[model samples]
Target: MTINIIDHFNEYFEMVPAISDELKLEVYKLRYQVYCIENLFLNPGHYPDNLEVDDFDPQSVHYLIRHRKSGEYAATTRLILPGTDNPEKLFPLELYCEIDNSGVMQPINREHLGEVSRFCVSKEFKKRKNETHTLAAIGPDQQDYFTSDERRAFPLISLALIACVIKVSHENDIRYLYATMERSLLQFLSALGINFIKIGPQGDYHGPRWPTVIKITDLLDCVAEKKPNIWNFLTNEGSFGQTRPIEKPSKAVRSNSWVGT
Candidate 1:
């Protein structure tokens, strides 16, 4: 399960670790904005704090991306190392099983795995036009046309977010990854070269529709093999990835289970 550290550096846009409190807050606030404000899960939850963080924070390393020139925080993602602070060693897998009794998503014995989650970008930074041009160095799918700063930004948010996590995963020696995502997002992930193994059929998401849980180590594999620019930033690049590595989640996770069987 070894990944090449130099594979994820972005030639056009330099990747940096979001280590400062201000930058981390920026990342946290963005999560709050996207998750709480946008409600991307296709269903709503009581996420009381309005902050998109969970217990995973304590055990994960966070990273941010900035334009090579201006050094602005355009995107962000966090990676939870296997057996670090993560109790489950995966993102919400236990919750997923509870949400859809349709099939088993495996228990959290957590062997060799890492969890990628809570990725987002500031709406203000994402709407800028220049962010789109960096695509050439990132490798192929710029499907996030981002025709307008407003419309185009949403999809880039996901792409950059995925890129952000990949950088962290490569450096930490983590090869396997896990996630519970929206079913409709499958097409979008495919365009970014993300590979997924869908676990079960649609069942319920607590209220409206069912969200899917998928495994994605294959996607990380491609990022390492294809994107050299991204890989550069991850190796020896300073700031974001270097954290004090906490074992407890900076905050507690949602105790509420996912939608029912």
Candidate 2:
């Protein structure tokens, strides 16, 4: 079947920036639900207000994906930028994990680095069989839930979230992004043609996670080459500036290396 991924995807999911207090609260609450209630990755009692927020959130930018038909949030992710006032605070990944930057192509500056973290998909919205205790009472038979088109669109929730991450980082002028993700999830994204370079040893966080990093241009380059439809969606059909082939960092920019220690 020749599926137009972007067209099918747009009919179901919409990305909302968590700019205001209300929207940010929604992101935190959803994180609490997914990480605390569903996944047991965090203790529910730790969040007295039922919002899973942390210190890094103050300087972070967030995004939420909504399932339009149901008017419910499907997933959320955030980019933690360096502290504007202090500028010495480290990213969550750097504080927690030992990132081997030897393989890095350029020296990094703290001001230019942003950490992508707190990614979660609401239990009810996911279609995979292995997960349970979801808000959405999905039946045993996955085929019975929605129409074929809807089925095709359902899985796009996660990808749409990633697209939002790319979009938000570009808007903020952040060129380098660090993330810690399950190796399996990384592999899955690679299967979808989104790849990140592994830079550290896999460690047990909530689960087995590997520290990884990606350049904005590299991400755009991969999408444009491997998944044109996704590239179109990310760039809004070339309007978002991701359509152009990504160029290497110029010598001048590389010289000033703002990569955080």
Candidate 3:
């Protein structure tokens, strides 16, 4: 039987145009679930209650999915515009990243560039893989967990977000795309056909680290082959984004935010 990927995906709302209180609480809850419950990042606070949310929250565009039946925030993510307001253009390293801001070369051209960060799934959606380790599939409900289906979904969402980010950049009259990331995720992105330039390293454990200069047009070109499947959400159980347990998460740096479903 054919599967409709988006069908399992809950209702999503962009946290831009306006900020609803319900939206705010949902996003914070997702943050608490992932950052606090899943990956305790030492800096504990009641802010997100489950995950982490810093000053960046105010400056970024938020995205969320909710249960149509319950209207609960299921999954959440935020995008940081390269320049304008967002420090990513200037520092690339996210909130936790620290550098001599005066000495660092800030990002340029607010138009085409943006950083994707703080992605999280609500804890209610997260599920544990088998003891041996494997991926999870989209079940009846929820959004925050890194199930096997999401592993497949992340790249697709990243690609779509990249496209949207660029499209928005064009509308905003900006050019050039840039974001700092890890060597491993960059490798995975490269396998999916994204070509990026290294911008050298920057930041603390909670900040942006080994950075890569991602050329958006070039990335689109490499991934163009799977455009239809990706754009159409042709994702399935055996997709490239299969979810797996983080046996040694510290070994490989993950840029996407967390949400345990």
Candidate 4:
């Protein structure tokens, strides 16, 4: 049976913006699970409240993917909007790695840049042997929480998260994106025709992560040309390519307290 991957994804999962405090909590809780408890990327004890949060959370937009049947959020990701008050504020990657000054990213407008970070999936959804507990090995699990088709659609979660990032960017009129990802994840994205240019040397933080950047238009172009199905799934079928422009926040809302997911 041919799987309509898009339908499979939509049937089982929904991607939503963390616009409210309740929704934001969902994002924080999931990050705590993946980054703190499960992976030990961050100290679990550091988050005494069981919610993983940091300085960047205050200036980021977040999204969570919920499993419709189980009502469990399976994955989460965030895009850190650039600082408006202080242009010199550093992105997580910039703080950890040396960005190349002489490159395609030099001319990009800072106001239009955002960083993609804090991507994670739940441990229960990781169901394959030797699968690195990442997107590469999402399959049916013994728990019966996911249907066979849902299991098959696991890899799409990563793509869907990227779609969310792109959606947030398009709505906000963002032009550039910075990210730090494992080389394996980068290669996987490449296989799906989502490409990024390395902007700095690989760093050891959270394992081997490469600092990379991409223009929003260039990313869209790559998807449109090399993976039309994915492009349609992201831009047309999902929440990313909505026609409504994101409303500009009022000055009061730009404060750190009002920002974050």
Candidate 5:
């Protein structure tokens, strides 16, 4: 029998909003494992409580993907909403990279913008052969915890995180998402029809990353057209429909040349 990717993924994993302090701690602890322990991307000594958090956490809404069978958090991501009182407050991308204000971003309303940040998959859930260096310690006894079909759907975790972002963005009336993404991640997302426009030169934050932006409407339309099943999964069977009318970026706005140091 052929497996429906959406059903297979839903069977083994669930997406949860980290609204309560307890659930939020789960998100933070998972981040600590990925960013501090596994990747060494952040200083473990700084987070004495063993929860990876920053000033942005207070302004962000977090989400987690949990392995239903294991009851363990598999991944976590956060959408940093625009400041309610101060809409002009710069996002992490604005502060760290030079955004080209003359083109596509010039007319954007900051109040309708949010940044996708702190996207990380837990080391325990990194099951792909190419991801061996992720350092997910699987015990001998737990080797068979995931069936072959379930393991095949593991890549859906990232898409589920994006779905979380979309869900929250819709609730908050956000129209554009800003992100500083690794090139590999950009390519992967592009291949899935979730394209982001590079708005700034590559920077060396968390290893080389490009400052990128995507309209929520455009993201949904592309996914819905190119991959209907994945779109159905992301939108929860059309429950999270587009909040705003589709608007295409003008041809006059062009991506900045990908300059790397």
Candidate 6:
């Protein structure tokens, strides 16, 4: 049976905005598991509470992909928006890697820029033998949740995270996104028409990572042309086709704005 990727994804997983403190903690804990314990890309000692967090988190919007059946958060990602108080503040990529100013990076608007950071999937969700050591490989135990055909759609988790990034960025009026990504991940995304331009040479950060950038409009256009299904999934049926600026909320209102499932 040919699976409808979007329907299959929605049936088994949920894209939740980590808007509340409790949900944000869930995002941090998942990051701690992936970054600190599993990958050792970060030192567990640095996060005594076992929650992986950083300075940019204060200016970021977090999202989690939850496995509906198990009620476990299978993956998490964050979009680090520009600082409200200091729009000129440097992103992590700026501090860690040298960006190429000669080409596509020259016209970036700082006020509308955001970075995709700490994107990871829990080990339990990674399903292939070769992917065991990577950030998103699934375990044998998770196999019971799906039939063989359904299992083929497992890679949607990564796409779902990208969808989250697109949604949040649109809501916040963010146009450009920066990320330091592994080559394999970049290739995977590129194949799906989600191209991110390499703006700098590879740098050693947790591992060899290439600094990249993508304009949200350009990405959407590419995906829509080459892979309409994926574009539909990412844009939620064209809802994010236009920028919809979300009003600034008071601290209290923001805290109560969303509840993750």
RMSD, one per candidate, in order = 12.1, 8.2, 11.0, 7.3, 9.7, 6.3
Those runs of model 6 whose alpha carbons end farther than 4 Å from true positions after fitting are 136-146, 242-261
Number of clashing residue pairs, candidate 6: 3
Largest lDDT belongs to which candidate?
A: 6
**Which lDDT tens digits does candidate 1 get at residues 111-136?**
45676655545544444344322211
Judging by lDDT, tell me the better candidate of 3 and 5. 5
Where is model 5 more than 4 Å wrong at Cα? 132-145, 243-261
Which scores greater on lDDT, model 1 or model 5? 5
Candidate 1 contains a number of clashing pairs equal to 16
TM-score of each: 0.54, 0.84, 0.56, 0.85, 0.86, 0.87
In order of lDDT, best first, we have 6, 5, 4, 2, 1, 3
Per-residue lDDT tens digits for candidate 2, residues 1-261, read 655566567667677888888998999999999889887888999999999988989898898887778979888899988788876787888788777865683676767788888877887666656545432222233544566677667666667777777777777777888888875568667865678888889886666788888887778777778877666656545545654643322232112211110
- Encode model 5's per-residue lDDT on 188-261: one tens digit a residue: 78887999999988987665788999998889889877877677666655655643332222211111100010
Structure candidate 6, residue pairs in collision: 126-137, 126-138, 127-138
Task: Report residue 240 deviation for candidate 3 (angstroms).
Answer: 25
Better of 3 and 6 by TM-score: 6
Candidate 2: segments with Cα more than 4 A from true spot:
131-143, 245-261
> What is the C-alpha local distance difference test score of each model?
0.47, 0.72, 0.44, 0.74, 0.76, 0.79
State in Å the error of residue 96, model 4.
1.0
Candidates sorted by TM-score, best first: 6, 5, 4, 2, 3, 1
Q: For candidate 2, what is the TM-score?
A: 0.84
What TM-score does model 6 achieve against the real structure?
Answer: 0.87
- The CA lDDT at 214 in model 4 is 85
Mind giving the per-residue lDDT tens digits that candidate 3 earns over 42-155? Answer: 345665345356666765666564443454554555556655644334433534443343223364444555666554444444443321110111233333455555444433
Tens digits of per-residue lDDT for model 6, 120-157: 89877776665656664433334454666447657888
